[model samples]
Target: MEPTSDFDPARLARSLLRRSRQGALATLMPGTGDPYCSLVNLASHPDGSPILLISRLALHTKNILADGRVSLMLDERAEGDPLEGARVMLAGRAEEVTEAERELVRRRYLGAQPSAEVFVDFKDFSFFVIRPSGAHLVAGFGRIVDLKPGQFLTDLGGATPLLEAEAGAVAHMNEDHREAMNLYATRLLGADGADWICTGCDPDGMDMQAGRNALRLDFPERVTDGTGLRKMLVRLAGEARAKG
Candidate 1:
């Protein structure tokens, strides 16, 4: 799909907010004046800013309390061509959340990392919130969208033309095309009969169930007509056969 002149920061934020489970957090080590990094599971607040829960004793957590400056890099990790996926980096200031706000942060964090139940009991682990300074949103290969913290958070509720149309296109393809679906699954996705399911399709693309997750295909153009849809299916099949 061609890039839009106005990028939807909110849509991008929500996508990052929904799909990211792990991020690389970079924190400044106090005495040494160096940066330390660790992988952390994060969740976003309703306003779309990240809320980080950390064990007080964890090295990164300790560094944050001392210096407050932090950077987080989140990316989609599903198996695929890495160039096709999205990733974002958030620069923020971390602070130990206030006692009154702790419950909300705790709930959101635990919702994403249910297994944190085991470690939540540990006295050293607690919620630390990040108030972002800025964000860098990257969609697929070279599409980079940068925003100030306020703009990024505010845009989360705004609509994007492509995403809106893409949803509808995905619905149409999945509902109407079963033969092309099977061929794509068998040929491109390399999945056996029992493994495929038509998940959804929209003007911009289709999603098919492959193994335990769904594989997404973007349309060449805003595809509402049957001919455009057929061409998409054929393209997918050709790509699958070529790759195989």
Candidate 2:
């Protein structure tokens, strides 16, 4: 495999925060004085904080309001090979979102899970934002990466160069360089020519139409325009040639 970039804790955390599906939420049971754990679907805010859309009447939701202390574990369930994946657990305080924040939370949550539209109408269902006090990241069996509380939960403000570069890379690759895609697929990804097709592009990344799934690549280098993108392609092509 090509040399992977130095493992970026923030980037890795952001990636996991963006992609994972289910999370285990541990909440306090009101009068019982015990902790209640429930499997809930969750999403991350743009800055990588965890949030949950839950029913106010649900056991966990009620438990949270009664006592805001809670912990959320967002991780990929081990399947097949255990050594290749990672997981993150976050401990935090949960609170019902204020009216001003509800709309933004709803948009992000609904965008990821359109199916929730069916049950979102329930009067009991509401949005809860979790502000993590600490986090733990595990990359594989026996490989521990611990982080301080609130490490990945900060607001960094408006878009930065990384985001713009990633977007420009995607747009240029998808719109102007279709032929180069198949070459990269075979030369870089080591795929058969038939397995590669350019599907779509945006400012963030390029989507490859591979079989049943789409593969997205977020370019790490700056690519602001067609000229800059061409230079990137040339560099990639030179790398392929060097490997051959």
Candidate 3:
């Protein structure tokens, strides 16, 4: 069947943004406009814009202050030629998040990296949001797409309740629902074996890890709460059982 209207390059680009925990950030230097690169941890706003916690004293923060235009590259690690794996380059403008959105952004950012709380309270620390203008995703050889942000990104406003509960859900599934997660990976995701453990879940998908291998599985439909999440898992389990 032909790809649906909703299925486009942006969807895959957004998938990269959803799965990546860390990415390379490049900013223009103050004096010469030279590109300065740094590693940054990533989180997302409800609109799928990138959110970063950076100290004002950091050079990259200075770059954002001087010039907002920036680019971020996120890629998956794979065996064999690294170029064979999927990766995305996102270009945008970065600016400090406003007061009204500060707390929620901070909460989401810190949820993924609780250790960041130690420095998050520091005087120089602040949150910045990167609203992408354009993106390019290379899904291995023979697949490439140029994406506009509007088409690819997910507006997760409906999933606020789910985002808030994600950390607890991760812990619970890894601890109590290992079998279900394993089935989700093997049966639904076509991943190898039952050793995968659930790491996190968002409205669109769930992430799992088997040692260094991270896998993301999209729901048959979007889910945005514990109830929906449970329903999806149960349905997936039933499907897996039926295949037995």
Candidate 4:
């Protein structure tokens, strides 16, 4: 079925990508080419693609090594009937992270899954990024739609400086401006949680988390560097405070 006129498949898909902490990963088994699915913990790349850290010894990892083609299923985990909740199936090629991007990927991944720090550097574990070619989203009746990569992925063009400064900015927010984080979550995003922390930031928005609960705070306008991010955040904080 075609999506409703007002339904935003792209936005819903992006939200699932950023907020989901775990998903079902499907890979092709070697030779026979059978499908092997496993539960995996994941984090988002800055552009909203899934980043996975899997050990070489795992069956799914071995299958991925032989064939990179994969699909990931992420859902909103909404209350009530599970099947009634929104979910997206992302089809892509999972490739090992390039050396030049390893540090950045690692930081973003660890930011969302801090417990991963315990074994993030293990020799057997490697980071992989799913470069999505397409996605299928199912929200409900009249909300099923297919999306091209461009439809759901965040555009990173001209945002190199923002990426370079992301780690430091996230650190500053989590460390020094936690009250602001709480304010953004409760006031602006209408989410309730304690000890909310900044997990990552991109040109499009900031990701915040409190334990298993996560929220995405889209910027009023895109920001491209540390200065722009700071200003956008300050403005958002003021707006959030004004709501009280």
Candidate 5:
């Protein structure tokens, strides 16, 4: 079915992928080919793909090793009826992170799941990225649609500088700009005030959290470098403060 011009399935799907802290990860059991599902913590890659860190000894991890194909379910976790909230089921291959990409992946994961730092380096644990093949988003009666990767995933083509500078920028915000973070949440994003911190930033948006509650702040325009990020943030801060 065609989505109305006003409803954006891609944007909704991206928000779910970015904001969800945990998801129902489904993998195929080796011999029986049965579907095995487990609750797994998650984070987003700079390009908006889901990231998972799991123990090699775990059944779901073992299933992934046998068959890389998997499906992940993420939702808004809204109040009241769960079915009334938006959700997306993403189909993809969950491939282990290559050595070259480990550090970047690790930083992004830990940013979202800070407690995982305790055992992130354990021999049994490894990182995997779900390179999405497609997604099925169920928003409501007329909002159901299948989105191709291009429709939902952020294009990182010219965003290398932002990706490279993400860790430093995130640290800088958390360390030196707590007030601004609070403003972004309370004023810009309309989130309740708290000690919100920047988890990660990509070309498309910034991710933030205060305890378990998460928020996504989309950039007014894409940023690809440290300077662009700085200016865009300053602009956002101004806009947020103006709301006062």
Candidate 6:
């Protein structure tokens, strides 16, 4: 057999956060002291903080307003047996984002949930950020650990170059780089499909989606700007072509 890669739980946990764009959010019910769970679509800040767009009328949003304490659960949904894959319960307090950060957070949310554009600007809707304090990660059966925020989250080298360019990059790829995107999905990830599209990208890597399937591809280096992204894409495409 060929040599296996080294295991890094922290890195795996970070990837899980990156790939997960939606999860169940748990909040404390007002006056009841009971736990309330609701589904929430999420995006990540460059530093891996969870960003959410919710309406004031939402029960979960009301709960957050009543008590900022909350938890977001993201997990890998595998077929067959569900517990075989990894899952994370991130405990954090949700804070309503201020005006200065609204656009930044909005763009991030749209990058993950493009459909939110319809109701994103409603008068009752608002944006919130969940600052994770700790996490409980179960990476398969025997692999489990409790991690601090720093261990499971990444800083993205401090420059959010890709964040600003995310929308344009995704559009350019889908409109002009279909073949290359499909090649990356099949060659690099060994995914069994050809209809893949580049949905979003960040400093760490890019995500590809095809029907119900999703795949993540890492950059050769931490890329922040268009020049770095172009160079990396060119190299990856060339390598994919050669391998094909």
lDDT (Cα, tens digit) per residue for candidate 1, span 1-244: 4336666754565456444667899999899979899998776553456777788768888888789999988777646776576778889888777887776566655645657788875888777777888888777544677768766552323323433343345456556756566767676546575545444333544545544333444445655555555576677767766765
Give lDDT tens digits, candidate 6, residues 20-43.
Answer: 888899999999979999998887
Candidate 2 colliding pairs: 56-124, 133-149, 134-149, 167-203, 167-204
User: Per-model C-alpha lDDT, please?
Assistant: 0.64, 0.63, 0.79, 0.94, 0.94, 0.82
Those runs of model 4 whose alpha carbons end farther than 4 Å from true positions after fitting are none
Candidate 2 is scored at a TM of: 0.63
Better of 1 and 2 by lDDT: 1
Instruction: Report the Cα lDDT for residue 116, model 5.
Output: 100
Question: Per-residue lDDT of 1-244 in model 5, one digit per residue for the tens?
Answer: 7777799888899989999999999999999999999999999999999999999999999999999999999989989999999999999999999999999999999989999999999999999999999999998878899999999999999888888898999999999999999999999988999999999999989999998999999997989998999999999999999999
RMSD of each: 10.2, 7.0, 4.0, 0.8, 0.8, 3.5
Which residue runs of candidate 1 sit more than 4 Å off their true CA positions? 1-3, 154-244
Q: Write the per-residue lDDT of candidate 3 for residues 163-241, one digit (tens) a residue.
A: 7776677778878988888787788778788577765677777766675456667778999888888888888889986
The best-first sequence of candidates by lDDT reads 5, 4, 6, 3, 1, 2
Q: What TM-score fits each model?
A: 0.59, 0.63, 0.77, 0.98, 0.98, 0.87
Q: Indicate the residue-level lDDT of 55 in model 4.
A: 100
In candidate 4, position 42 carries an lDDT of 95
